[model samples]
Target: MSSTANTTYTTFTGWVDPPTDIRPPLTENFTCSVAVIGGGLAGMATALRLAERGVDTVLLESDFCGHGAGSRNAGQLASAPGGDIQLLNLLYRKGMPAIIRLTENAAGHVESMIEKLGIDCDYEAVGNVFAAVSRGQLGRTRRIAKILRRAGAHVEEGTARELGIPHGFLGGMREIKGGIMNPGKLLRGLRSAVLASTVRVFEQSKVVDIVRGNGGVTVETPGGVILAQKVVLATNAYAGEWDITPKRLSSPMWVTEVETEPISPQRLAALGWTSRSGLITQHNIMENYRLTARNTIVFGVRQIERAASYPLPERHPDPAVVADLAKAFARRFPPLADVAIDRTWGGWIGITSTWLPVAGTVGDDVYYSLACNGHGLAQATYVGTLIADRIATGITPDDLRTIWVDEPKFGHAVPMIMGRLGLRAAWTADRFNDMINGSKRHAREGFATAAGGFTAPA
Candidate 1:
């Protein structure tokens, strides 16, 4: 059967080129002990885990590795694993340790995978700076630093003035282990590692349907089919049309990133940003800034609502996103007021309502793994490994396995309808809330509700 669905998602920084290829379609009915769906980081990790166990498995991709959000993302290698403890404590109540391990290690796992497989994805561990753009954000960052310290993660206190910063910040939080990376190279390395294994990896073989028979499950694709006793679904934003879509806890959110032509090393030194570190302003609507290996200045923040207001223009990047990016860059880096923007790209990020990962067996033969809440670059891989391990060992504990699989208010058919609408309202409301000194809080909270959940604490 042929199906026509407006099911495509777009990204801003990543529409440039496709990843190196592997092989071709299945071209025949094949059977394995397990079948994994979606070829992004999560899917790749799941398949790699299964393969490591010497389990017979088949991995399916709608497009190619990293072709989706996997490859198109701004590669932020988070070292300290896990979510905000306060929010996790609220959502999980007494349940925290296991989920933290699964989500937080995702950041570390990125580095581990790169080292283990010798994949050169520009893995660096220079550290990340989380600063407050206002008094409210200052308090929040301080509290966040306390939480990380209590959790035993390495952290430090740094003031914007001491750090020689921009945007006129009061103070900041520092996480030294977090680093920068080339997202596409990371995904490419994983794909190469998976393909080199005995595990079967197939591309351009989009799954059309899934069936659970008396014996096992079967994943049907246009070119071929995969029959297995178990299956894993790792498609994040693109998995919306499936029965498992509701399993995601947060709503679909969009983000955009822009890269500038390399500023001379001398220019960077003069700007006080030559140090190997990334920075984020904890404003109402947060903004992140980083210096790339090539000395280019990159910045990312909330832009999904704006992108929805304007789809992928026939032109490379919608002028709105480009223009807004230019404005944001100038505001953050007044010294680089004359910098040239090389390119801009955007990608969709999945979030969960509970502000935690949602992973568990949907049916007996099928399992779900998704919603890292913009932390998928690491969390997804960590969650994917846990899911694969549990499935392999058949150890599905209620506390760990059953905690998040059912979190609510996630997945979107086309979020521009409501999500983008909420963003606009929040932007308007935030400006008004500023008079009462609650502008940042109100705006962040607004976007959280627009996302159908409370935004995770800073």
Candidate 2:
């Protein structure tokens, strides 16, 4: 396929665009108490928090604020942790309580922000489901729920029907917190809040380099430079692009999502999706499905594309990958099989080898928080708030200290060639499992086999 066909697969996101109140880019030298680079959720939240405390802060974005992953995500306000909860419990066993606190607080913080700032982003606290597509996956979910609960998360285990989830999934765990929203609207609202603050905001001001001086840092942009006593690197996936940032801070991954044409309310009701809670499958690279305010279903992310190098270039969702997502959607919701996919878009997300969100300082003056995995919508905002508080008071909260690392020790590199092969293998395995234990068959089979033998459903 032509590069244009791939690049412009979906030019615009289906979400309603918020008002564009443009901010001018920096054209001359500027100075501030804290200079925040990148204007996504983390950066904006950090700047807003600092400015609220009367700190001289300047935020610079290559594009408009929230134009990156903040506005490009599935919009699920997840309270439970991302990645593998089981693995996290094993690796950070002692830090489980702190981790759980951070996850739960992240979700709560978003709701608080919405109420405080009066953001009308269609906020809902209906909670989210860790749905299973097969009998084996259902068993996995039960195990995961145990791990999460042990870590002090509020997780309820039940059958898909018992939990009010649609028919396509089997029994799984439901987090007591979290919901869905129009991320575009939420991000725009945050941008507005930040703009209202005393902080200086600039758009289209990409920082090309950073230099550490005697007592402060110098941020070099094309149009000008920013001299500040402290700097917050809220760039997330783009953090690796800067030489000053640790090379393995984040591995950039691209994920795609698609929205469907609005379905009839009656048809939506027929699917038994009454709760309207977002759903995520138990695959290695999970697929997410959620209900939109417009009566449409949005789903995507059966595959991910990893950037080969840093300073990531702008790209679009591949038409072939989007087609695969549509196919997955059809298999999961046969009733909506014929629904036309309205649009498809993708964005870069940061993923660390540890598969855990992290925050720390590179030095006395440079601070960073990144790799929230795919659950950044809430974590990013909360982490930013924590970082801002630490910068202002020089006192780190438990939450901030939990993820704070003095030096980044990255994992071994999974060669791109091997990574692609591993992804293919995983996709193939999921497909094979789907064929053997189809949703209908798994649902009919009732409860899966327990440690002893097949157990009856409750």
User: lDDT of each model, Cα atoms only?
Assistant: 0.66, 0.83
Best by lDDT: 2
**Which digits, one per residue and each the tens of the lDDT, describe model 1 over residues 241-330?**
465445324455566777777788887877655345677665445567777766776676534543332122222334565666676666
lDDT of 2 by residue, 160-195 (tens): 778888877776888879899999889888998888
List runs of model 2 lying over 4 Å from the truth: 1-8, 413-418, 439-458
Per-model TM-score versus the true fold: 0.82, 0.93
CA RMSD of all predictions:
9.1, 4.4
**Whole-model alpha-carbon lDDT for candidate 2:** 0.83
In TM-score terms, candidate 2 sits at: 0.93
The top-ranked prediction according to TM-score is 2
